[model samples]
Target chain A: MTATTSEPGLRPVQKSRYKRRSKGRGNFEMWSWVFMRGSGVLLLFLVFGHLFVNLMLGQGIHAIDFAFVAGKWSNPFWQVWDMLMLWLAELHGFNGVRTIINDYTEKDSTRWVLKTLLVVSALVVLVLGTLVIFTFDPCVDPGSTLSQCK
Target chain B: MTATVEENTEAKPGAVPTFEVTLRIERYNPEVDDAPHFEDYRVTVHGTDRVLDALHQIKWDQDGSLSFRRSCAHGVCGSDAMRINGKNRLACKTLVKDVNPGKPITVEPIKGLPVEKDLIVDMEPFFQAYRDVMPFLVTTGNEPTRERLQSQEDRERFDDTTKCILCAACTTSCPVFWNDGQYFGPQAIVGAHRFIFDSRDDGAAQRLEILNDKEGVWRCRTTFNCTDACPRGIQVTKAIQEVKRALLTNKF
Candidate 1:
């Protein structure tokens, strides 16, 4: 039988075969990790408050209608609250799904395609949601019976 | 007296009973076999026998071709670590009875690293990760004439992580490490934790910077597999969390 041994001074596994996209570029991952924790805590409050106000305070889920939403948006406090919730929840969820994709996807092409679709969808939702909040017209409906429409 | 002596030679009343255990070992001979497969060997062993003993029986009596790495069969050498009953464990440390000897015990090489032969893997990658973390004390300034002094509390700070044997059990059990070979794995993080929390080490910043890379501690999903697989019970997941917290707070 022939005796054999591994070569001397083999390269570190991380450096040898696997391709790393980020070149140790400043603490982006650190910040991403920090963002996950921070955004998670913030989302708890924002999400719970949104649910409490929308579903529990005064009128419950049945009270939620088009006019009810318009009335809430007409107020600056509620608009800012909804906008914060929208952005934070969307971005927080986006970053989360992005992390999942990064963890699971093996091929670079698969990661790129998934992340691209994620970014595009997130951008569309954020832009559309923000515009809807800012430029909301309660009087747009001709059959509206709200006091603001008069 | 003659009858008692013969009976004593036959079977002692309190002596441990022996049973036959079938070990289903994953075998791969790169020279011959294209893919890995399981081969069973039945061995009669005492209740006190370890998995290593069963392996030795198979190697010596049944199949001379069975190959495995082992040293200090009592488990200190960190060799002979493999998947026993689907869990990462040192064969020398795992008692056959503890692994449910009633059924077949599965012995396979730890995952993630390339399998070199039956129950042996290319540990270079695992060691490479360990080395990248700088698993040694880094001190600045001239060597002191006297040994550096540390308080009891300071010593206890990183006491848990100092028990790492580098068996690759914790790293192999990690799903993240299994999927992404580039991620620095839990063993590397535990190695960094060993020195990062050391009161005397001046290399915390450099090591922390190394771990702060994209493939660093950020990839840890807090699955606790490393913690569970740790033979030394080093609280692997907690150490990783502490390192992550240190990265955020810049304090150890």
Candidate 2:
């Protein structure tokens, strides 16, 4: 049959032998792209706020001793801030690495393995971080010099 | 080099060894056939002959019915791009000696495109995608009396994407594009990148917004097929990555 289009000015559609493959179920990739930007913006503030408080405030980098950290963690506000920073940065970093892995890895098993390690590592950091932030008691150490601990 | 040429010419005399190169070209006549089929034609070619030259010999000497597109006979013009041995390449650029000289070379229209008769594909969809991205420069305000000045760094930023000749090789090679026709292939993305990163162009935000759709830049899985298929050796994947980064940070 001669290549012919029923509609004028339109090219004839040659049926491809290949089957149509969907990227994924629902709008995962779309949300993934949006998350990168949204999380990235939030991360900028969280990260910078963390650095400014730790490095540039008061005695600057020299003031960041064990007592300084203990003093900050004594307040619930700092606990929440640290919590947000940990979660957002970890998830953002995870997503970024996932994208890189997807782009560079050639084999399916390699991608799966790398991604599994990524998610596992992120979860480990998240769980340990959340635990330390919420459950830490500086008073437990008898030799602690922190006024807030006393 | 001159002595070598003279000695070779003297040794060969009037006879230059020529061998038969069979072209199993895909043939489809929309006027009559419902499906496509391969038709083989044997053409004599020398070592330096390109696939386009072989096609010319076939069309001129063997059968006038053979149909293909060609211009400039070099890599320019972006015409006569076809699949030679399952890979998209410019027919004018592909030397026969490099692509299976002893066996029949399979010449077919590029994939993910509608075949229009013998080796030509319907390029309407490809061009439509290119047009959809608004490939031209979009600037606001009155036209400046002088040319829009751009820094060397700014020019270098998007220098790679500017080499696109509108060849459908990159687009047709993409598996995502083949699976889904609606997705703007790397060709269109590269075109948008050409303008999106242009320092003088005020339309980067607009173009980025246009490309932020569901079927837009996000659809690219970074298979690197487009980069591999590009005839100009343009960094197609790098351009796409730059576009993606722009979308994320709102900066090109």
Candidate 3:
């Protein structure tokens, strides 16, 4: 009997033969790797700063009431901070997931559907989040013209 | 090795040995034209010679311009996924002889992703969906001074999700993803599945919140294509179902 080995089918990669696509914008993978490191570094600061402000400052975690949120939104500084956080977190998190999808799902139709849902959802959140942060009103004098919160 | 198997058809049992089948393949060239065209080759094939092997032979002997990506040809690397006839398959594991005995096969690149050159599809958008799932394990507890111990049951629960090979078979198979590129797709579910069952994670409730929005897990139509296409034999629909069940029960 001839001695044989487990078929290379089990070794999907040793044959590697990974030649990057010849045509694309430029350095897609390189920029992606860079983006991960950059985003990771930025996320560290954003996440920590957010935690410190919300959980450790002033009355600390107890200051998270709706009024606390309205108070912060009144200040442009907090608004921008929240905006940046929202955008970065959403983009960073979403982009990371897009990578995983391409790697796993094989069917073109499935991939298409999944990605469509992702974009629609992300867009909806981004738009609504941005609007809420920018157009908030805190004064509630009852019959005042400040809309519902008034 | 597979070619040799075809060579031995005459040595078998009283059953008449079957002849080989040809596989017609689509070819593309960026420098020459705006479209891709078909090319055919007749090769005597056996049950062992997968379509991938046949393509390899054509490249090695007939055309050097033919290009494709394959690593760990056994299907672990998640590369070499393409269309065989109408279904998606890993070129390595799919045995050509089993697919058809009397007719030639057809091979094409996966849809949804931008075709970069020939069989290779651009993966930037797909990768983007992975990031959105928050695939990493996040903990709010104090940093462990020692290895965190987990009950064997907890570990066992998440074992299946951790096995994802990221082959793109499941995601590309969904109809929802075909029209919209932003859907998180199947791998994200697999990634969420990995941590969702872990007792070490406090992020399950929060993760579900992230997945609950309009574009979240609700987009799945329960199509079993993703489950069917998984090279690792993962139950994609099962994982999705578990997540859906959690959302309904936990009310988080």
Query: How does each model score on lDDT?
Result: 0.84, 0.79, 0.70
**What tens-digit string does per-residue lDDT give for candidate 2 at B1-252?**
011122244456676545677899877788887677778998878767889999999999988988988877788899989888888899999988788867788887887677777778778878877887788888999999998998999999899999998878898888766643667789999999999989888898877877776667887877788888999999898898888888778632
lDDT of 2 at A23: 33
CAPRI docking class of candidate 2:
incorrect
C-alpha DockQ of every model: 0.27, 0.09, 0.01
Ten-residue stretch with the least lDDT total in model 2 chain B: B1-10
Model 1 C-alpha lDDT versus the unseen true structure: 0.84
Write candidate 1's Cα lDDT for B95-169 as tens digits. 888888778888988877778888888888788888988999999999999999999999999999999999999
Taking candidate 2, what TM-score does its chain B reach relative to the real chain B? 0.92
TM-score of chain B of each: 0.94, 0.92, 0.88
Model 2 residue B101 lDDT score:
66
Candidate with top DockQ is: 1
Q: Give candidate 3 regions above 4 Å deviation.
A: A1-150, B1-19
Q: Write the per-residue lDDT of candidate 1 for residues A19-88, one digit (tens) a residue.
A: 4445675888888777778888888998899899889998699899888998999999988998998898
Comparison by lDDT, 2 against 3, better one:
2
* Most TM-score-accurate candidate: 1
Question: What 10-residue stretch in candidate 2 chain A is worst by lDDT?
Answer: A1-10
- Between candidates 1 and 3, which one is better according to TM-score? 1
Instruction: Point out where model 2 deviates above 4 Å.
Output: A1-30, A34-150, B1-16
iRMSD of all candidate structures: 11.1, 12.0, 17.0
TM-score of chain A of 3: 0.75
